[model samples]
Target: MSTKASRAAARLMISPSVILLLGWMLIPLGMTLYFSVLRFNLLMPGDNPFVGFENYRYFLTDPGFTAAIWNTLALVLGVLVITIFGGILLALLLDQPMFGQGIVRILVIAPFFVMPTVSALVWKNMFLNPVNGLFAHLFTALGLQPYDFLSQAPLASIIGIVAWQWLPFATLILLTALQSLDSEQLEAAEMDGATPLSRFWYIMLPHLARAITVVILIQTIFLLSVFAEILVTTNGGPGYASTNLTYLIYVQSLLQYDVGMGSAGGVVAIILANIVAIFLMRMIGKNLEA
Candidate 1:
């Protein structure tokens, strides 16, 4: 077939799936937008009257909304800081030759595969339980207090758990990038008496710059919407200590049975999420260009 004919045939083969995906996404969005302007509540089923931007006004004026925003930013920043620094150290360590290297790498990358709910449950029960958890036992043995992670430090604990889960992915990406670095340059630097710190700062870190930025951009997208961990662990308890925007939206939509308000929150979340995504995409594009 001619090139134009083949192009047309390729488009024909892909159009259905593309159209289906668009419909799937746009239909729910349209419904959400429609509902967001109404006064609908599942609990008080009556006339679902049109109330333009009233839902948005209520949702935005909510006291929890502000806290949720801060918590979301803190959570994302905490995870990014931990994962970027920790992943870099791990990548550097794993890059070195050692016995059982393959096994170590496997173990390092294993946490990324565990489901978020499962990992959060494990952290809550096995590690962070104040009574019979591993940390409690260790604290008791050391003659110290058994700290309650979920209660006392809900947001930080979630950050730690999330960072642990994402570290493997960051490590894998950075390791791949590190592996591509030219060895001869390092050898020359070493012969010229470059210290380890100097070698890492001057040679290695610059090489991993693009990979680090990529990891940050990708991880931020998912981290902002983190819910399962907060739900499973703290339930955003202690009065919104761990409640991010995602959890707040869930509470409004399901728990409160206020579909209109929930839809408003959803619309706000979509706007904020899109803004962040667009900013990150621009950064990624600039990095790629560089």
Candidate 2:
């Protein structure tokens, strides 16, 4: 077929999927946008009147909103720091020719496949529980009092749980990147009297920079919306201590039955998420160019 004819045929074949995808995305977004302006509450449903920016104002001015924003940022940053650093260390170890390498790698990445809710539940009841948890047992055996993780440090506990789930993903990515590193350069560095730390600092770490950025970008996107772990563990409780934007929206909409406020929060979250994504994308672009 001629080039123009082929191009036309390709467009014809892909048009349906493109239209469907657009509709799928745009429809809910349109509804959310529509609802965000109305004072629609489950308690008072009759004659929903339009209230332009009122919902946004209320949602933004909410006392929990600031705390939620801080918690969301802390959660994302804490998880990213842990996952990236831990992943790098784990990746280095996994890259070594160790016994049962394949099985070990599988075990390392196994946590990623586990459901977030399941992991949170395990962490909450089996490990962090102050009464009968493994940690409690260990503490008692060691003649120490068991620490209440979720209750005493809700945000930190959530961060640790989320970090555990994402660590494997970062490890897998960093390991793949590590595998592609030029070993000859490392050998040359060793021959040149380079120390292990020096080699890592000057060669390995630099080589893994792109993969690290990818991990951060991808993980940050999902980390912003981390809800399952929080819900299963803290329920955004201890007074919004672990309440990220997603959980805040859930409370506004489902718990409080304030659809308008929830929709407004959702919109704000989308804006903040896009802002972060765009910034990361630009950074990735710069890294790629480098």
Candidate 3:
């Protein structure tokens, strides 16, 4: 076959999947951009005016937007810290040769398979409930007032739930990376009188840097759009305490019936996602180059 014909055949084979993926991605985005330029309210289905950047201005100036941004940042950072540290510790522990290690590893990974809604519901009612929850029971036994977790510590509650779900993922990634480290390198470090801390810091951490970056990049993408846990637990309440950009956009589009503002928020979210993606690509590219 000629080179041109081979290329044509390859393109024909890939065209269906490429077109499908492109349609899935672009349809919603195109709709968002379209709605963003028009003053369309779901409740009032009538002649909508073309508003240009007015919706953007409204979304930007809204106080809720700032709060959502702050909450989103805090949630992402908090989850990252917990998952990274806890994952490393758990990975180290699991790497040991011990009895029933396989069972323990399965147990460790089980939480990641739990649905977000189920996890959130279990946490809110069975654990964090002020009235009939485990914490309430403990407080009652100790003669203390039951704490309202979702009401008072909504962000922390959401973070805890999200971290619990993500911990296994981070651990698995880091553990895989750990298992790939050169045993000879570790032996040499020990021979050089390197302490455990020094070996971990200089040898292990440096070796795992790429894996860590991958985990961070992937986690950040999911963490930025965390929604189901927050929806089930707090519903972005206690006056927008746990509201992130995703929830804020949800409220704008669904609850408020303001399509224009919601689309503007969607645009902002896309920009933020792209910024994070660019940074992650740069970081990974630099690591690959090194």
Predicted candidate 3 versus true structure: per-residue lDDT over 1-290, tens digit per residue: 56998999999999999999999999999999999999999899988899899999999999999999999999999999999999999998998899999999999999999999999999999999999999999999999999998998999989999999999999999999999999999999899999999999999899888888888889999999999998888889888899999999999999999999999999999999998899788887887888
Clashes of each: 0, 0, 0
Task: List ranges where model 1 is wrong by over 4 Å.
Answer: 283-290
Can you give the TM-score per candidate against the true fold? 0.95, 0.95, 0.94
Cα lDDT for residue 21, candidate 2: 97
Order candidates by lDDT, high to low. Answer: 1, 3, 2
What's the true lDDT of residue 143 in model 1? 100
Candidate 1 has its poorest 10 consecutive residues by lDDT at: 279-288
RMSD values, in order shown: 1.9, 2.0, 2.0
Model 3: colliding residue pairs: none
* Local accuracy of candidate 2 as per-residue lDDT tens digits, 98-120: 79999999999999999999999
Model 3, TM vs. native: 0.94
After superposing all C-alphas onto the true structure, candidate 2 shows an RMSD in angstroms of 2.0
Worst 10-residue lDDT window, candidate 3: 281-290
Candidate 3: stretches off by over 4 Å? 1-3, 282-290
